[model samples]
Target: WLVKKTPDRYEVKIPARIFHEYVAFMRARINKGMGVAEDAIWSAATECLFLTSSARTKKDIEDNIEREVIGKTIGKFRNKYRSALRYGILDSAPDIDVLLLAKEIDAAVVANDFGIQKWAEELGVRFVPAKTFPLMLKEYLKQRSSISHSTKSDFFDDFEES
Candidate 1:
């Protein structure tokens, strides 16, 4: 049986507390890297990252620089993409929203918070630590682009090796 090709789009849900940091980190890495265009980076981030915030989490962002980056990246994407930001009434704290959204979307949750991770695991949701999520995403994007363009029979094998 032939395995299906990788889908062009994927989503990751995150808490609002981590949202600002994640966006900032991703934007910096994409900007510093060569080949990947800024437009495509934003598109990827918007499509892949899921975020829901409580008012408290939104208020906790203290650094102006970080807030600015978040605003420019996630904030702009929300306005431009419209549907990328998922908003709903919370039955609990905003942190749980990560797990809730992940389950809702059938997507992975990228978070550093222990509480979120624990709850996510209990719910049988896929979870990735925040520290490594950026690298994983970058690799995912690379593989996705390759699959779209590569005709090599061993492309998947080569990707695994690299």
Candidate 2:
């Protein structure tokens, strides 16, 4: 759900759900003409790590149970609670995983889900919209490439001068 660039490579940290939905994630980028983002994700995948937390799983189960029980009983207030409480809330295990991991590693979350975005803001985690992720990656790569090329050219020029 998010990527962090280290000196050597990009580190993509995702939950099991994202890992399972990997194809769909890439397809979405491809559909949006974001081949660069897709490529970036693929390249990061080589160094990616899939992680899960028992605490997150327990919280997910408890939340689900509470929601199910409350959902059935709150006939009159159902609409109100549904709109206010559930509208922009983390509802899945993957959601929790993304937030927790991003917080732990101090990485920006890349997701379009409103729930995830809302929670990221509440948790003070940085967020990158999925739509613009490719653009950002492309710019970064271009800058790095240019810098490398210029450095090489400068080295060669110095050698020739010498």
Candidate 3:
């Protein structure tokens, strides 16, 4: 319905490592006595995040002053690429491909990672908060429904007043 209804182009991009992290997170919780709601969240994420790798990872970040402050103040982001290397977020870290895709496409990313969002902003990209997505979507649909029903509702209101 979303793809069909939206009049604009929809493109998908992902960090291979982040994608893997989400996938692994979902898989680990499966059949572990998760309740109905948890299962639904897990299922929704698992189903939606499934992707076929179309490109390899690539990034192009230069160390600078703001990056230093941002890294220290907000959250764990400054050394995200480095930490990815140490923690093996992917088989390798610093997947420039993820950030490069954001830069090249000039699109907003949906993510929970402050690192990805901050760097994306620095690179002239946008990021949508992961938790806020459902609320946004719900409000959008609600508005659409209201508009769709308003014509009939207005006619009925006029008749009732008469």
Give all candidates' CA lDDT scores.
0.59, 0.66, 0.54
Write one digit per residue (lDDT tens) for candidate 3, span 1-162: 455565443355555567556545543443232344444544443333333222232122223432463334324432453354324221213434566676678767776666666666766777788899889889999999999799889999999999
By lDDT, is 1 or 2 better? 2
Better of 1 and 3 by lDDT: 1
Stretches > 4 Å off in candidate 2 = 1-86
TM-scores of all predicted structures:
0.36, 0.48, 0.35
For candidate 2, write residues 1-162 as lDDT tens digits.
Answer: 798855642355456466436644543543454345444543343222212323443334445544464434444344554455446656555777888799889999999888889989987999999999999999999999999999999999999998
- Candidate 1 per-residue lDDT over residues 113-136, each given as its tens digit: 666677678778998999999999
Where does the lowest 10-residue lDDT sum fall in candidate 2? 45-54
RMSD to native for every prediction?
23.0, 22.8, 22.6
Candidate 2: TM-score? 0.48
The candidate that wins on lDDT is: 2
Question: How many steric clashes between backbone atoms does each model show?
Answer: 0, 0, 4
Candidate 3 lands at a TM-score of 0.35
